[model samples]
Target: MGTTQLESVPEPKYWHLKTVLSEALDSEFSVGEILPNERELAARFGVARATLRQALEQLELEGRLQRRRGVGTTVAPPRMGVAVGTEQRVWPGVGEDAWQAVGCTLAAPPAAVAAALETPREQSVHIVRRSRVSHGQPVAAELLYVPQTSAPELSAIDASSEAARARVVLRELHRLELQGQDSAVELGSARADDARQLDRLPGAPVLVVTTRYFAEGRTAALSVATYRADTCRLTFGASGVEILHGQERQAS
Candidate 1:
């Protein structure tokens, strides 16, 4: 909102504001540092409160700021990134890991998941739901699908089975070479169920990462993970150079 010369870079005011706020958070602002109220910030910037709020939203999406009901906005600490790859099934929260499974079910799969599993639309697959929390907030929710072929040994699994089926499915999958996987990301809103599991409001932005596992030239499994864009920066590759635009950005 701050006035600038015409020759200045052509960028949205909110984008500029987000950059300024991000810089402040990275340097002057400590974790949990309470920022000036929105009204004060808007007045100082010479922009409408709504405009300033938009800027704040972007910063919050980058995990730079967090706002509470009664409390003002504050700096949020960095979020940790758990590597995503076609690797062994490491038990959630059991191997000193950040992933934790909260529930499991065998239900009719979504069309996308059903296609990936190469199974009949009517057939059900094990949906292993897990949550990944870093610092104090939930960062991600994962839905791992286990096709019947991949879990033939689960016939004995029951309601009180203690997540044994999920464990067994992952174990069988690990035996293969796990040669490669194909993945695509898209912007999506959190469904009601995912919202509850992720501790987010319905329709909140999420980074939907879909993966198809491969072993010995055949499909192994499929996993769809929805990460809270407001609290996570998904890192993928050698040095994590991808932009933090969430699911709303155009593919590069």
Candidate 2:
């Protein structure tokens, strides 16, 4: 007599596909290696295009992969630590790190930014927007303010010239005797603009890092940086490195 056998159900398509693709990225793929187009991957997996895209979106959000407009999805490297305050408050480029100034603008600050800047609601501040990209993937976006004093020398600079503008800001900031700094990290969602710059949808989860640079006992400069939380683990002070390995969240 032939025995009837119970068939095992295939894993839920999205979860199974994401799991398979994630493991593949960790194993076969090296950081920055571009993957086959999503269409091709979907075909290979025998799943609908939506299902494939869902999985890809998850990977990108988790920083396991990155997707660009003209370019395709590529494996993402680890997030940069960027040494918050190791020895002393050094000026930019003092170390091997490089910070590229994306663009600069003058506008009314957000409520939080205004509060941090200790400026009036009607007062306009020069909001310099900067982005840090490492290993070909965008990592952090920073908003810096000169407060008219931190960069008093900037008036001598030709703002139209990118290098001139960047130099003016850096030159003035470096003049500060490198005093102390205070930083705070809190749960945040990418605002409309941040999400756009970070290449994610509105309301995407992010770690907002606000740091205040003090020199001569006064607030010298202030920076509000947003880091992709899914792909980043924000560390603070001397204890952060030890805390990074505390515990990994278990999959529900």
Candidate 3:
């Protein structure tokens, strides 16, 4: 690659540089390849280091690059197509689900979750924590809330550990006939717990997916999943699209 001076344009210099860098990424770089240092990049583009930094930050926000602690900046993988909705009728933790149950606890949910669950504010519910990984990287962390009313049988189970409690809660909850599910997606900043689970810095951009599972004419369970916005593109509808790091495939 040769040094090329950027021409002045009406738009911000960093924004224009971002465009040029994006093109170069496609034509000259491979995924996971570390980019040159900021000084080198600035000198090559004939832009100030400050402008180059701005452009790099924009690229990282757009999921085109990753800034690792020790690895520096590298080309990021393509956005993974995460299926948020499907026609198949099934409960979570059932039948080849991508999430892994990490732990479970009994705690009063947040006010919004309590309202959604239609439980008293002080009532403790079963909170099942789960995490999803793709390409060996954590992509999402979830909190599955099951009201005691939703999984009454759990009371009888002698769950000795957190994982055991999670299993029993899931088992009892699955006994309910799954009627349907609905989900809503919105932008969010990673909270401390979610940030740790997702391996992102505090306040990093995230996509919050809130889902309600229905059974017996009531909201049986609620799930709040936090996905790394840079790594995920939420997909809806029955026809699923599976996007891997560097490839795309269709799933039905």
Candidate 4:
């Protein structure tokens, strides 16, 4: 009989480091506690700075750690559960919505948004910028596209300023009878503008949520909102008690 050779299995350094760091976070660290400097951590772990950084990035994505550009890394608190689905279908800005209008502009939306809104490519739409803040931290940035036909009541006077137009666009949208709404969520990287508003680096992890508003048997508006994947737990259903772990979902 021929001798059988055992195959060697090698684990990725960063992945292994991430596992070790995760345990440490659970037993050794507290929320908001500052961690050791990257240089010291890398040396202590006997790993390259790049490897350590990769592990740290993974931790941050899992909401286990929080990293700032100027400030050092710190333990992150539990992700906030943000309700995405509700029992009743209602237009945004109708109830006590969490979004706050930032600005508005008349411009041609992206090709995808135009297609979703069923609008002509050449026609400009009302682009309303909004931001969501939770626990005093900016969590999401959104761009709501409202076609001219959907919000025909808006006037030139309303477009004179960004703030005024934002309110007008939302107000006009409320006039229409909202028949239904739908949303889809996926993982994505933050765009430059969105990253700036979210106070994160460009290309950071984000949960892209695309929502469509229906009125008069047609798509009235389309909203693209990007939430910080590191710090938000997008919730659904009637009861808001359900919580999701970001790392487990990401791994799947």
| Model 3 per-residue lDDT tens digits across residues 211-247 | 9999999999999999988788788768532335547
Which candidate achieves the best TM-score against the true structure? 4
Which candidate number maximizes lDDT? 3
Alpha-carbon lDDT of model 4: 0.81
State the lDDT at 121 in candidate 3.
95
Top-down lDDT ranking:
3, 4, 1, 2
Worst 10 residues of 4 by lDDT: 1-10
**Clashing pairs in model 2?**
none
Quote each prediction's TM-score. Answer: 0.70, 0.62, 0.85, 0.86
| Cα shift from native, residue 68, model 3 (Å) | 2.1
Error of 2 at 158 (Å): 5.1
Candidate 2 lDDT by residue in tens digits, 1-252? 111111232755676677778888877888878898867787677778898788877776676776655677778767545434444565553454445677665557777766776767666666666776755656678887656556665554567766457656766778778687777888788898888888766666678878887776667767888887655766544422211222443121
Task: Enumerate residue pairs that collide in model 4.
Answer: none
Each prediction's number of clashing residue pairs:
0, 0, 0, 0
Q: Look at candidate 3 and tell me the lDDT of residue 8.
A: 49
Candidate 3 regions off by >4 Å? 1-7, 39-53, 153-157, 239-245
TM-score-wise, the better of 2 and 3 is 3
**TM-score of predicted structure 1:** 0.70
Error (Å) of candidate 2 at residue 115 is 0.6
RMSD of 1: 6.6
**Model 1 CA lDDT for position 52:** 82
